[model samples]
Target: MENHFMKRSFLTLPLVIALTTSAAISQSLPPDDHQNVASLQSAADQGNSDAQLKLGIMYFNGQEVPQNEAKAAEWFQKSADQGDENAQKALKALFR
Candidate 1:
């Protein structure tokens, strides 16, 4: 009975190790900047209010990107269309 139990344990040991090692390897991969940018760009393109607001702020502050008031206003307008108070405030600030 003990030998039988040991055989079963040995059989599962490799599988358990494989699963853990694969998970570790997958977790170790570096974050993809392009993937992040693509996700943000897609959300912005789809007129997501939050994404638009973030894009507007990025433009306004040149954070990890370029600064352009016109672009900022454009994105803020999109977000404002969704009734975002912050975007509305930004738009007013930019235009006025």
Candidate 2:
């Protein structure tokens, strides 16, 4: 049970950080997902799992964009395909 909890904590830590950091950033910006969204999409299209993971979070939390779990799952899938552990964990949670 302890080990399971540890694993859960490890898995969720990235998302927590992503949310917190995104919130901090959002408080200062126009909150338009366009620029970053385009950049993130470009990176994802170029096979950058890090960008894909970040984009997924942005969509999931509606931080910089409207909430869209399906789009979030799609981006997470792309990142997970590149062996991004955080993306894989997020995809698992979204699917569940």
Candidate 3:
């Protein structure tokens, strides 16, 4: 049980960091997803799972971008494919 708890914490740590980073950077992000989001876009395009997850949330919530379920799924799928635990959870939640 202790080991399981540790593993769960490890898995969730990235998610916590991603969410915190997203919130920290949100104010500086472009108001439009299509516009410049160089740091995030660069990392995501390079297949960074965390950035992919962030993009998924932005699209899903219309945080800084227009709400588009399709785009959200697309980003989440990309991260999930990379074995990001948070992204996998996000994809599941997005579908349901």
Candidate whose lDDT is highest: 2
lDDT of 3: 0.75
- What's the best-to-worst order under lDDT? 2, 3, 1
Query: Per-residue lDDT tens digits of candidate 3, residues 1-96?
Result: 999878777775665565556656766766674434578778999998878888887887677779887987899899999998877876655454
Highest TM-score against the true fold, candidate: 2
Model 1 Cα RMSD, 1 decimal: 20.1
Q: 85 in model 2: Cα distance from truth in Å?
A: 0.4
Regions of candidate 2 where Cα sits further than 4 Å from its true position: 1-35
lDDT of 1 by residue, 1-96 (tens): 999778777665543453345335535778662235467769989988878877776676565568787887898899999998877766765553
lDDT on C-alpha atoms for all candidate structures: 0.68, 0.77, 0.75
User: Where is model 2 poorest over a 10-residue stretch in terms of lDDT?
Assistant: 26-35
